[model samples]
Target: MVDADQTFVIVGGGLAGAKAAETLRAEGFSGRVILICDERDHPYERPPLSKGYLLGKEQRESVFVHEPAWYAQNDIELHLGQTVVAIDRAAKTVHYGDDGTHVRYDKLLLATGAEPRRLDIPGTDLAGVHHLRRLAHAERLKNVLTHLGRDNGHLVVAGAGWIGLEVAAAAREYGAEVTVVEPSPTPLHGVLGPELGQLFAELHREHGVRFHFGARLTEIVGQDGMVLAARTDDGEEHPCHDVLAAIGAAPRVALAESAGLELADRALGGGIVVDEHLRTSDPDIHAAGDVAAFPHELFGTRMRVEHWANALNGGPAAARSMLGRDVVYDRVPYFFSDQYDLGMEYSGWAPPGSYDQVVIRGDAGKREFIAFWVKEGRVLAGMNVNVWDVTDPIQRLIRTRAQVDTEALADPHVPLADLLP
Candidate 1:
């Protein structure tokens, strides 16, 4: 049995940290659990921020991980609106809050998460500039969308990544004119890769969302502290009321970095290094969620995943590891996104050039299809667009790494289960 006197400190207020605390208590560890959140609100799931909540489809309360009373009822100490300034690794303590109160930790979990990568351009400080990462930002954006719709305003979104596209879809659904600026030739170039980028580009374009491919927002021009237009490097000025900077996010590693924890290289997306068990350089210290760069034995790579699924599973896995349980955090990478009428679920990692072939099953034009990234006759990744009930088979194929016949893979008649080893 675990010592009741031991205290575990979790420095984050997201799904991962909250779920970790819940797991710790459920596992019968009657120890002190301290959850420190930089945000004033209770721990919440982030997926709804960009999708349902931003579209006003979900209530504000729906985004939260648990009810406000759940923490108190479970004897979990929640330090809301508090920041951990530094960590004394030698002393095994964390200095937090403005007063720098030191809290001793028997085991520490760093789930600091990631921050939105802001635009470093003129007029980004304008009143109409928006970035969606937090609940507050989504609330503000929701109001902005409502106001824009009522006034027939135009929203110029920089980058065609998941956030940008999702918000663009929301803006369009709200009756606002939308234009997306992306440096790549197609939307989601970095993620979907070249094979399926055009599919998304066309999907957005079909919904009246204009695409400015092969371009990037160079500057945001405004008058009287409000956005007027966005200038792209391709010598085009798009007149708009607001600019949404959905470029990307940077992993929050300051706390772990200051504590001298080993971090992954910038090339690997730069996160605090954790072994298969989610243990950092210090065995007692663990990291999960967007802040952790963990090795995957299946993929034979170290990666940091910034998605809802990662936090949902990573937290519980880390909690078990913290309890000295045998664990190998090698679950296949997965993520999902909803935009307009299309819902997509992606499994596994297949970066550009990693897969030799891109196979499509079913109708791409109808947007109900499964696209698989296959290399060496084995599936590396699969994306189901507007398709459901096949995630298990898709993940199984990726997990088993079984060599699949191309003819059967592209055939809708063949059941995915038959492809499994």
Candidate 2:
């Protein structure tokens, strides 16, 4: 049991940060826990923003992770709208500009999430352009969609990843004309490969969403400080009232870097570097969530995944390590995205060029299916759309490294449980 009044400082107010605070209390660490969140509003559910929230189906109040009363009951000091500008590692303190307050942590957990990548092209600073990383961004986009009434207004969504597609789906549901522009030969080609990319592109195109493939965005054309159109490398101009840049996200490592801590090996690629226990070079300070680059147990590679599940699970793992408990942060990477009427779930580490065969289940035309990515007659990774049960058994196989027959996987009638060894 911890002392009744021990001070612990946590940076960032996203899922990872919030979970760390809750877990500490639940673990009997009844201390003075301070949560530093830059956003003015309290921590809320982010995934819903692009789906139900934008559709006006889910209320803002419903999305709050914990109630204000819960925070009070747990004795949590939530410093909303406060930013931790710098970390004085030598002094073991975090300096904040809000009230010139310095927080000293016995062990600090950096869950300082990520920010949406913005286009540096011309007219990007226009009034109608936005990136959906925070609740405020979603709220503003929602207001615009509501005001515009969908029919006359046009929305140009750059990138064809989960975020871009979800945003496009929401806009189309509202009756707005939506056009998705991707420079890749196929949508999500960089991540899902061309075949899976074609499946995703087809899903969107079938929903009345226009596609601009193999087209590079040269500039965002605008006038009087408002976006008007997006010009492509092929010299084709596409008109739009609003633009959503969902290209990708970058880790918030400025504070970590400034403290002279060893940053991740993302100088050329992406993510912050961390050991198996999720600790940075400076053992006193630990990093987790989307910002930290964690080493994979099975794949034997360093990677960074920006997913909600990982953020929730990684924060406490890092915190435990900070408290001197040795734990290896290893789990099959999993993520899900909801677009239109699809609930897509993907599980396991999809190392580049690891899978040699794909066992597809159900009909793609019906949009209800599961696709098993197999390597050497073993299930390496699995994706399900409208099929939640597939993830459970596949996750089990991944956890145990179970070998299975590829023919069983390809057979639609064969249950996932039967393939488990």
Candidate 3:
């Protein structure tokens, strides 16, 4: 057990940071714990911000990770609306907030998370221009969608990534006219590849979502600081009262960067460089969640996963490591998404060029399929769309590293468990 005088400082208020504090307490670490959050709200999960919360289906209280009283009860020093301005690596202290409150620590965790990438083009400052990364943003969007629905106005989403597509679905459900502009030919081109990407396109099209493929938003034409329409590179203009920038997110690594922590290269998904144990170059510091680019033991490469599961699992793993436990945070990356009536869970990494073939088990046309990315006859990743109760078997296939027969893998009659070696 650690001495009570020792202190651990965590510089984030997301799932990862909150879970780390819980883990530290559960592990019997009788030490001071400090959690710094830039946002005023309690530590919260972000998935609902773009999903159920935006749809107005989930309660506002459901977003928070813990009750307001939980922090004080747990003896956690929670600092809300306080941003860590600088990290003094040599001094082992952090300067935060407007008044520059100082906090020293024996160990530090950078779970700074990520921020939504903003549109670099013009007219983004207008009213009705939205981005969904925080609960406050979700609240604003919920109201915007309601107004758009009532006014019979339009919402143009810029990007075909998960955020863009999910927000599109929510907007449509609210009775707002929706249009998506993407630079890629298909939605989620970088993630699901062309085959599965087209499936999403058809799914949205069936639900009245217009797609502007192979084009990107260049300008948001507005008047009196309110969005009017958006223009694409193809010179086609989409008239809309509101705009949502769902392009992507950049890791919040400024604190880590300023502290001279080594960062992963941009091509490898830039973030603070960490080992399998989540320790940074400084050894006394660690990073988790979206801001940690660590070596993936299974894939033999560095990866920075920005999913809810990563934050959920990574925080506890980092907390264990901080407690000097032999922890290897190699839980296969996992994440789930809900759009309209479709629910999908993806496991493992299978980016483009990493897999040679995508084998489908169920009917792709029906959208009840499990698609596997295979290379050298081994499963690289698996995604189940509208399928139930197969996450275990799917992840098992990825972990076994066993060569699989394509025919049997694609055969629904052949049990996924039977294919396991």
Off by over 4 Å in 1: none
lDDT of each: 0.93, 0.81, 0.94
Higher-ranked by lDDT: 1 or 3 = 3
Q: What shift in Å separates residue 227 of candidate 3 from its native position after superposition?
A: 1.0
Winner by lDDT between candidate 3 and candidate 2? 3
Task: Give me candidate 1's TM-score against the actual structure.
Answer: 0.99
Q: Give one digit per residue, the lDDT tens place, for model 3 in 1-421.
A: 4689999999999999999999999999989999999999999999999998889889999999999999999999999999999999899999999998999999999999999999999998998799999998999999999998898989999999999999999999999999999999999989989979999999999999999998989999999998889999989999999999999999998899989999999766799999999999998999999999989888898999999999999999999999999999898989999999999999989988989999999999988999999999999999999999999999999999999999999999999999999
Off by over 4 Å in 3: none
TM-score for each model: 0.99, 0.95, 0.99
Per-residue CA lDDT of model 1 for 6-102, tens digit only, reads 9899999999999999999888879999999999999999999989999989999999999999999999999999999998988889889999898
Report the error of model 3 at residue 219, Å. 0.8
Model 2, residue 238: displacement in angstroms?
Answer: 0.1
